[model samples]
Target: MITEEYLMQKLSRTMSEKLLRHARGVADTAEKLAKKYGTDPFKARIAGLLHDIARDFDDNEMLQRAKKYNLTVSEYGFAMPLLLHGPVAAVMAREDYGINDQEILNAIALHTVGSEYMSQLDKIIFVADKIEPNRKHAGVEGIRRQANVNLEAALLSCFDESIRYVLKMGFLLHPTSVKARNSLLVDQGSFRK
Candidate 1:
């Protein structure tokens, strides 16, 4: 098993200072949510810490990394390679970091643009990345508060904010995010409570 120290050292070497802080914040928040939701706190922390491991890559580097890992990219991913960082980091966390745990990898991969029927660890990482202490936004507090009550509701709230930000900034809306929202709202009946 890879120790937290090893992961932290790798993160320190690979990420910029600002990103390193964000990763720590996400890990802290993920662990807290994991405990509250009765998931594995260790897995949550590891996924959160390594979720942004590939975030510093430039466009070319991002593509090369994806190719190296045989990870497919959509047209939007090619246009905005930053979005592929989650997938790329997932690959790295497996091959480079010797993380063979599927739950951790899935959480890291889906953290950026979530997928349908996300596992508890996946939801924890996603919400943690969005509502971590370093993050400041209009609806973060609401999501943070909701997180304590309902994990799925917090995910829905976070996705709503993310979609709004994408529209406001004129960024391409990834279909995965839309599907994630739809699944939470419609398929999962997440808001029924």
Candidate 2:
């Protein structure tokens, strides 16, 4: 198990204070979600602590760092390198922090753009990143409440919110997020919203 002290030591050396605070918030939120949803809270907390390890990197740096890893950048990722932070951080989490759990790595990598087939831990980390206490947005509180009731529903709301944000910014909406949202709706057998 990765101790909080160990994570803080590693993070403090590479992350900004603001980023550390966000990571702490995500860790706490992920643990709570994992406990609520009957998953491994330890994995959730560990993934959360390391999820944004490369978030402070600039756009070019994000791309550069990703190349050093085993990951391939998607078309959307090339267009928006900001999305590469998760994948880059995943590599860092594995290499620098010596984390070997695929579940935690996937959670870190998928937290930014989400995935079509998200594990329970993946959903926990993803939703926790959005609803963590340090986060502030329009419908975040509603999403937080929704997360406690239904993880998938909260994930759907998050997808909806992300899509809305992309549209608002006139950015390309990544198909992965769209597919993820559609998958949730399809499973639910409705798409009224």
Which of the numbered candidates is closest to the native, going by highest lDDT? 1
74-100 per-residue lDDT for model 2 (tens digits): 888889999889889888888889899
Candidate 2: worst-modelled 10 consecutive residues by lDDT: 62-71
The per-residue C-alpha lDDT of model 1 at residue 88 equals: 98
lDDT of 1 by residue, 7-81 (tens): 999888888999999999999999999999999999999998999999999999999999989999999899889
lDDT of 2: 0.91
Model 2: residue 103 alpha-carbon error in angstroms:
0.6
For each candidate, what TM-score against the reference?
0.95, 0.96
Give all candidates' CA lDDT scores: 0.93, 0.91
Point to the candidate with the largest TM-score.
2
* Per-candidate alpha-carbon RMSD to the true structure: 1.9, 1.4
- Model 2: number of clashes? 0
